[model samples]
Target: MSSKSEERREHTCISCGINISGTSAAKFDCPECGTLIYRCSKCRKQSNLYECPDCGFTGP
Candidate 1:
């Protein structure tokens, strides 16, 4: 059995607000706070803007 810390948490796309886990999602850290952010391929491909929930940093 996997420990709680080892369990993968569900990630939501910061751009489209869609569930990204188990999909082809891009993962990166918030440039300001190091908070992990996920973006779906659709959004990434379109260069959709995303805001960091942790630091209010917005970018494409």
Candidate 2:
């Protein structure tokens, strides 16, 4: 696989199927499932932005 493909990719949230990056900044508790999921980055450069880097699933 290419280096880009080998790069560390994000993980899909079971609740929302969003990229969580498997990092605390990108993870949060899914009230519907009580499990951590890809959420708004508390310290991200931009707010109100949520999407799956792989699947491109936008937040409702």
Candidate 3:
């Protein structure tokens, strides 16, 4: 089971740096480094690119 803190932790969209806490954000692991990445719905729809912080891998 997840702890309360873990459940309440907010993630920022990598493309726009917005809080993705209550939005329909896309969540996936970075292809290069397996780091978790989040993208807001709008950014995802527009295909905004994001770079993985761990491996610096950019993707659409």
In terms of TM-score, which candidate is strongest?
3
The candidate, 2 or 3, that scores higher on lDDT is 3
Which candidate, 2 or 3, would have the higher TM-score against the true structure? 3
Q: Model 1 segments beyond 4 Å from truth?
A: 1-6
Q: Rate residue 51 of model 3 by lDDT.
A: 89
Write the number of the candidate with greater TM-score, choosing between 1 and 2. 1
Task: Provide C-alpha RMSD values for all models, in order.
Answer: 2.8, 9.0, 1.1
Instruction: Give all candidates' CA lDDT scores.
Output: 0.88, 0.50, 0.92
lDDT of 2 by residue, 1-60 (tens): 548654476665443445656555555554454444555344353445455444555453
Judged by lDDT relative to the true structure, which candidate is superior, 1 or 2? 1
Clashes of each: 0, 0, 0
Task: Tell me the tens digit of each residue's lDDT in model 1 across 8-55.
Answer: 777789999988878988888898899988999999999999999888
Task: Arrange candidates by TM-score, descending.
Answer: 3, 1, 2
Best by lDDT: 3
Error of 1 at 56 (Å): 0.7
Error of 1 at 24 (Å): 1.0
| Clashing residue pairs found in predicted model 2 | none
